[model samples]
Target: MDEKGGAIMLEELAFEIAKAAHAGQTDKAGLDYILHPLQVAAEMTTDEEKAVALLHDIIEDTDMTANELLAQGLPDNVVEAVEALTKKHNQNYAAYLAGVKKNRLATAVKLADLKHNSDLSRLEKITQKDRERAEKYRKAIEYLSK
Candidate 1:
């Protein structure tokens, strides 16, 4: 566990954060929002990606700041990847989504996550526009992952 190149216990952390952030949140299909992050983490193959999965939405939706997350003892790379995926202050939602599409690590998680959300869950609770947005995100995920 103390190996220099080792990945830490990450899946559990990711799932915990997902559960907390998505608490009481249900998709249009009546599924819990926590499932989205879990699905994203499930797609990851590395510890770094797993850590990023756990924290992907924390900064955007919660009170957690990037600096605070950095102070929580996570590796710098994981923090960077998550920050790259996060949408910061921007007036254009489409542009913000476009930015995320260009990040490899974030796009990977986002693709898999959105795929599960829109495909598996059928977006039962989301609006038509939101569904369209999810579709756009899915397409971006595909392009980015490629």
Candidate 2:
């Protein structure tokens, strides 16, 4: 395939991997798990950012690993941005948000993620854990805005 084709293929592959990884999963609102990544990707301004957004939860929520992402031919920067967006186990929300803020692309993706996760309409279905997460995201938004 040509260069352009390869790029397009990679993009498609990223979406496919994300969909497969999150299959059978659902959000707090009972929406398909894939919708979150799709929405995050839609909010991004660049292809690379969208790619990172699409795979943001793969490492944390699925069996997919960072090494697998690289082996699948994703660019180093995209992988790095995805990594930055992923929260490490036991890491504080503020610390994870700090990493996201440091990376421009990751910040963009994370802001979108927070926006979707914190939507007012979703409040009715949210649990205590969701409330805490939303609060953290709100704080992160403020921190990132500065």
Candidate 3:
């Protein structure tokens, strides 16, 4: 109806999409996968930022495309940020971070994503591989923090 109402609906839609897209998925810690995006979105300040955060992993992990999200009525900026946040299968981590840094919206959401991802406490058991991944996330956080 109004501007604020539209923003709320957008974020709600993002949440619904993310929930469905990640259904039956679990994180490395075996927690429900949707919690990651929910936590990331909670750290965002604006509705659009929250929406982007919620949908950030959709395209990367699911069959959904950016165009599909656009068709669902998400704003272009939100979709663009979500698209930027998606790292291609063949893309290097550093290169992906570089692209993420180029978009302010994606950067903010990514910082939150990295922050959540870096928390080893979320894992049931810490392993070499987990530590290594956290280290990589730490560096990405450092790079994105600048």
Candidate 4:
């Protein structure tokens, strides 16, 4: 397949995997969780980046494994980026962000994810916790930006 066709296929598979993985899940704002990935994917400029964006939360949030994603015909780059984006058990958020920063694709997707998550308008009501979380995201963004 041509590169374009290949990218489309990867993106489609990532979308399906992410949707199924997040089935019945809702974000803090009570919106369907898949919307978050879709929003992040929309901001990405390349197909690989879009696929990574779509699947970023799969390993961390769902039972889906990176090997399973790889076995399904997704490219190594996409799987690796998703893996980099996944936060491991007991992993410090700063350390996780540092790992994410090591992968260019993951870094782009994470920045988009953080920006989307930082949007206060997404929440019906803002709280002190929400503000604090947003501040953390801001710092992550700053760190990743550097």
Candidate 5:
């Protein structure tokens, strides 16, 4: 297979892993969890960025680890971007978002994630936790845009 073919295959594998990891899960709005990543990936401008977006929540929400992502043959840059997007358990949201902003590709993927996550209409169905998250995303956007 050619280089492009390999990238396409890697991307397919990322989608499969993400889909399975998020299976049976639903967003706060009661939508499939996979929909969130897919939406974020759709807004990306590059294949690598899309792959990072797809796997953004994998390490955070699933049993998958960063080493597993590297073993999957994803490029180092993609793995790094995904890692930046994954929030650590005890990390402050602002600090995490600031780190993401340091990487251009990660920033783009994160902005897409924030855009979907902070959608105004979804506020109607959001819980207190979701409201707080939305506010965090809003503040992060402001910080990143500066």
Candidate 6:
């Protein structure tokens, strides 16, 4: 566990950016935002995984890009984990998903995030369009998991 784990991470500037970027999301399926990453980190049984959860969305969603973070000395692997979880806007989603399935860090983080999102839609209460969008991501996750 990190010396200040939850508190330190949540208070970090980058984490704050992610929090606000996803602020409107409540994960109504009863899973708390914090719990989602905690579960992913728990899957690896490591402190960094937990911390990674707090940061997975930082780069992709915030103004603080991955290069900037690396320059700040956040460590290569940590930066990799966050990047692994990020959605690539320009690349082929199919190829990206394929790449993730073969590597544990990217695969694990993506699956954990996907699984958490999937579990929340149990009742499946959303607009058809929204459901369709979620289904695409779900299919991608399922394909990667296999």
Best by lDDT: 4
Model 4, residue 5: C-alpha shift (Å):
11
6-60 per-residue lDDT for model 3 (tens digits): 4447788899889999999998889899999999999999999999999999999
The TM-score, computed over Cα atoms with residue i paired to residue i, of candidate 3 is 0.93
Across 1-146, the per-residue lDDT of candidate 4 in tens digits comes to 54765544778888988999999999998989999999999999998999999999999898999999988889999999999999999999989999999999999999999999999988999999999999999999999999
Better of 1 and 6 by TM-score: 1
Candidate 2: pairs in clash? none
Question: What TM-score would each prediction reach against the true structure?
Answer: 0.72, 0.87, 0.93, 0.93, 0.86, 0.64
lDDT per residue as tens, model 5, 68-121: 888877889988988988889899877898789889878988888888889868
lDDT of 5 at 104: 84
Ranking by lDDT: 4, 3, 5, 2, 1, 6
- Scored by lDDT, model 5 comes in at 0.84
Cα misplacement distance, residue 137 of candidate 4 (Å)? 0.3
Error of 4 at 27 (Å): 0.7
CA lDDT, candidate 5, residue 43? 92
lDDT values for all models: 0.69, 0.84, 0.92, 0.93, 0.84, 0.63
Model 5 residue runs over 4 Å out of place are: 1-7, 123-130
lDDT of 6 by residue, 13-112 (tens): 4444446555654455554454455455556544555556666766665576888767755567767767776768897888777766665666767777
TM-score of 2: 0.87
* Candidate 1 whole-model C-alpha lDDT, 0 to 1: 0.69
Candidate 4: residue 24 Cα off by (Å): 0.9
TM-score of predicted structure 4: 0.93
